[model samples]
Target: MTPGLPMPVPAPGLPARVRIHEVGARDGLQNEQTVIPTEIKAEFVRRLAAAGLDTVEATSFVHPKWVPQLADAERLFPAVRDLAPEVRLPVLVPNERGLDRALTLGADRIAVFGSATESFAKANLNRTVDEALATFAPVVARAKEAGAHVRGYLSMCFGDPWEGPVPVPQVVRVCRALLDQGCDELSLGDTIGVATPGHVTALLTALNEAGVPTDVLGVHFHDTYGQALANTLAALQHGVTTVDASTGGLGGCPYAKSATGNLATEDLVWMLRGLGIETGVDLERLTATSVWMAERLGRPSPSRTVRALSASLGSPDSLDSHKE
Candidate 1:
C-alpha cells in the first residue's frame, strides 16, 4: 500500500454511481455439470438479493436441449420473482422461442447475446454474426412493447477461438447494431478472456469513436487468463461503469474450448473498494459466500485474490504472538 494513498479511488469520468449486475445464479450455474436443484437456485437468488445486488440475472429461458443446466429457468423464475422488487431479475432470451418462454413466465428485463467473431457466432448460434443480430430485432421489439428493458451482449469481443484476432470494426459494428436495435444497454464480452489492457483501451476507444456511448456500455470479462480485473480497470478508465462478474468465479463459455472462469465477484468488489469506487457489495459476505460455493463444487476458487484473503482469514491470529 502506498503511503497516504487512500484505497478505492474512483475511476475518472465514471459516474459517481455504478451498477454491478450479479450473474452468479444464471451464468454462474449454467456451466456446472451437476444439476443444481431448483430450490438451491432459488435460495441462491435470495441470498444474492439480500447481499445488496440490485440486479441479479436469475436464469436463462433457453431450451433444455441447448442448455440443460438452466432447464429449470421457468421453475426458478416464479420461485424467486418477489425476492426484492427493487432488484432486477434479468433473464437471458436466446431467440424468439426463448423470448416467448420468458414472456410466458412474465419476464421484465431481458438479455440477448451476439458475437463479434464470425466463427464464434456460427459455433454458438449456428448462424453468421449478421444473421444472429437479425434474429434479435423482433425479440427486442416485442420485449420493448411488453414494457421490458433490453440488454445486449456482444461476445468474443477481444479475441475468437477460431478466428483469432477480432477486428475493432467488427466489435464496433456489432455494438452499434445492438444499440440501434433498441437495447437499453450493451455489454462487451471478452468471452475468451484473452484481453490485455492495451486491447481493452483500443476496443473501448474504437467503440466510442463509433458513437457507442459510454453510459450504455458494460464490460463482461472472463478470468481465464487472470486479466479480468486489469481489463475492467481499463474499461472503467474508458468511462464504463457497469461490470459483470460471477459469485465464485463459476461460469465459462460452452462454445469456447479451454476457457476457464468468469471474473470473481469478490475480487471485483475488492478492487473497486481499493480504488475508492462504491459497488455497494458486502465484500466480507461475498467472500464467505464464495468460499462456501467453492467448497460445494469441490473445486478451488479461480480468483487469486479471494484465495489469498480466505487463507489469511483462516490463519492463526498474530495479535499477541507478533512480539516474537
Candidate 2:
C-alpha cells in the first residue's frame, strides 16, 4: 500500500469501494499521432493488469481508417485476453460490424460510444444522435445476448467543442436511451475536459432524478482544464463508484483538438487511497507501469503522482518531458 495523503473526511454518500476502470490501452492510445506497436500495446495491457486493475479496457474494434493507432484490435485482444480470469478486457465496438468482430474474438465484455450533441455525433460517428443510438441498440442487444457485459459511453456530456454547452436534459435522454438499449453501465464523459465539480453534481443529480441508477454509472473526465480529479471527487460524493482513467494520462479526442488525456489512474488512486476508498490498485506498481509506458511513448508520464513518486524513488527520468 502506498502511504496515504492527509485528506479531510470523505464527503457523505461516497462508496467505500470504487471500481477504477483503466482505459489507457484503448481510450488512451487511440488519439496518439504515432502508431504504437501491437506487441508493446499488449505488454501495456499486461502491465496494467499486473498493477491490480480489475477492469482494463483492452482495445477498440472501430474501423482502422478512423483510429489507425488501434488497427490491431483483432491481434491485441487475443494477446491480453487471458492475462487474468478476474480482469475484464472490454473493447469498444462502434457498430454492428465492430460488434461482429469482437464477438468472433470471444470478447465477453464490450463498450459502445455515443455523443450527447448532434455536431459531435455526426463528426464522430457520421450520424445524428438518434441515429447513433439506433445503431448502438442492436450492437448492445447482440453483445448482451452473447453474454457480454456492455458499457455505454456518452461523450461531451458537459460541453461540446463544436456546439458549446450541452443541456443536462439532452444528456439525460441519451443516458436513458443507452440504458434502454440494455447497456449494463454508462460512462459519462467530459470529452473536452471542460467539466467542473459543479457540472458533475448537476448532471448526476439530473440523471438520478431521471431514474438512472448511480451504481451503473461511471465518470470519464479529461484533465485539459485540470479538473478531472476534482470532478471525480464530486462524482463519488454523489454515489458514483466506477471511474474511467488512463495510466500515464494517455489519450485525447481526435475530433476535439483542445481535449487532453483522461484523468491519470495513479492520481485517482492517490486521492482514493487518501480518502480511505478501496480500489484494489497498488500505487507503486501502477506508477511504475505508467513510467514504463512513458518510456515507450518517448515522452514522460503526465501523472503528477507518477512523477512525484518516480522522483522520490530516484527515477527522475520518468517525469513528463512534453509540455502541457
Candidate 3:
C-alpha cells in the first residue's frame, strides 16, 4: 500500500472473491478528445481481458452526437467476438434505439444508464428522474426477455453537481425501479466522486432496507476527490462484491468539468490485494497494460499504482520486467 493511505480493515461480512467490472474500454475512453481507431479500441479490450479482467464493458451504443468516441461500437464489438468464453463483453445501451443496436449486434449483456437526481437526469438524458426510469423500464424488460443480462447504472447516487447531496431514499427508489424492471444487477455510480465512506454506508444500508440484494449490487466511483478506494472499502464491508473501475483512470464526465476519472483498476487492485480480497486480476500485468494504453493516449496514467510500478521497473517500456 502507498504511504499514508488508510489500510483496509478486514470486515467479517466481506466476500472472499470480488468481481472487478473493467470499464476502461467503454467508460474510460468515451471522453477522449482523440478519435481512437476501432481496431485499437478492440485491441484494448483484448489486452484488458488478457490481464485477467473477465468482465469488460466494451463500448456504448449511444448516438455519435452524444459520445462520438464510442461511435465505432458497431465495428468494435465484432472485432472481439471470438474472445475466450469466460470473458463477458457488455455494451452500454442509452435508450431503446441503443438497445436495438446492441441486440442487432448480438450483445448478450447490455447496460442502461439512469439518474437519481432530477438535475442530472435532465442534463444527461433530457428527461426528469421519473421519466428516465420510465424510459429504462421497457428497455430493461425487452433486453431481459431477449435472454440478455441487463445491468442498470444509477449515476449521481451520492452527490450531484447541480443538486448538492442526494438523499438515500431517492437513490433507493430509482434502484428499485431498475431492479423491478428486470435489471439483473445495479451499479451505484458516484458520478462526481463526492462520496465519502459514511455516505457509502448510508446509501447501502438504505438499499438493503429497501430489499435490494447486495449480491446484485456494484459500486462505480470516480477518483476526482480521491475518495473512491476508501468509499469502495466501505461498500465491500457492507457486502458489495462487484466494483467498476477504469484501466488507467482514463475517462471523466464530459458533462461535469470537476469530475476527473473513474477509479483506476491498478489502484483498486493494490488495495484489494492488501485486504486479501481475490479479484482474479494480476496487478503487475494490469499495471503494464495501463502503461501501454497510456502511451497510446500520449499521457501518463492517473493511477498511483501504475506510476509507482512503472517507476520501480525503471520505465514504462520495461513492462516485461514483471512478467512471470
Candidate 4:
C-alpha cells in the first residue's frame, strides 16, 4: 500500500475487473464479403461471453439495405438472449428506426455513433455532425424512457480522412453535446488510427475543461500505426477509464482508409497486466481464442502478440521478442 493510504482488503483471489465491450459480432462481421449466418453470429457471441468478456456489442439494428449482414439482428438478439446473466449485450442503433427495432427485440443497452469530422460525417452518415446528433435525439430520448443504457461513440476524434487533423476544440464540442443530450458514456474513437499519446492527452484535457466527467469517457483506438495501445495507456493516465477493444483485433472502420484493426485484446491485456491495472481477462485463453478466430477468418492474425505466441508454441526461441 502507498504511504498514508489504507491497504485494500484482500480476498481469497479477487479477479481484476476491466470492462471490454466486444464489437466482433457487429463491427467485425459487418464488413465481410460473406454473409455470416445468424447461427454463427449467436455462437460467436456465446464464445466471447464464455471467454469472460462481460460486455459485447452484439449487432447493429440498422436497415437491411444499409447493412445487409445484420438485417437479421432481431433473430440474432433472441438467439443469444440466454447469455450468462452478468454479461451485457448492447446493440447499435443508427436512428429512431433502429432504436425501435432494438426496443422490439428487448434490448436493454444500445450504442449510438456520432462523428467529429464534418466530411467524414457527410460521407458515412450523409449528414453534418450536428445533423447526425439531431437525428439521434429522438433515439436517445426513447432509449432513456425505456430505461436502457446508451453509449455514444465520437468517431474521428483524432483525425479525419478528408479534413486531416481534427481540432481538439471540435472533439470537445461534440463530446459535450453528446453528454448534455444524454449518454451514459462517450467513447472517443481514433477512427483513422492517427492519434499520438500527446494528442490523446490534449483531447481528453479539453474534454475535461468542458465539464465532461473523465469516468464517462472511454478510449477506442486502432493500431494502424502501432499507437492504439500507446494511446490507450495515455488515456488511462489522463483519468479516463473504460476502453473499447475488439477480440483478436477483429475490426476497423471500413470508411476510414488508413484505419486498421482495433488494439488486439491480447495486446491490450498484456499491457494492462504489466501496469498492474487488472483487466480481469484470461490472456492465455484470450490468445488461444484469437488464434481460433484468425483461422476461421482465414487471414493473418493482426495481433503481434498473437503471432509471437503462435510461433512460440512451435519453437521456444520464437518467444524471445516478447520476453522482458
For model 2, the stretches where C-alpha displacement exceeds 4 angstroms are: 1-12, 253-260, 316-324
Which residue pairs in candidate 1 have backbone atoms (N, alpha carbon, C) closer than 3 angstroms, thus clashing?
8-274, 8-275, 8-276, 9-275, 9-276
Candidate that beats the other on TM-score, 2 or 3, i.e. the better one: 2
TM-score attained by model 1: 0.90
Compared with the true structure, all predictions reach lDDT values of 0.82, 0.89, 0.88, 0.80
Best by lDDT: 2
- Tell me, what's the RMSD of every candidate? 4.2, 3.2, 4.0, 6.1
C-alpha-based local distance difference test score of model 4: 0.80
Candidate 3 lDDT trough over 10 residues, lowest sum? 1-10
- Model 2, span 133-212: residue lDDT tens: 99998999999999999999999999999888899999999999999999999999999889999989999999999998
Preferred candidate (lDDT higher): 1 or 4 = 1
Candidate 3's C-alpha lDDT?
A: 0.88
**CA shift at 203, candidate 2, in angstroms?**
1.0
How high is the lDDT of residue 131 in model 2?
Answer: 95
**lDDT of model 4 at position 261:** 68
Cα error, candidate 2, residue 207 (Å): 0.9
Write one digit per residue (lDDT tens) for candidate 4, span 1-324.
Answer: 112212334333223445776777888778766677898778788878887778888999988898888988989999987687888999999999899989988899999999998998999999999999999888888899999999999899999989999999999988888887789999999888999999999998888888887888888998888899989878877766588888777784455432356877777777766665666666666666766666666664667767666665542222444444
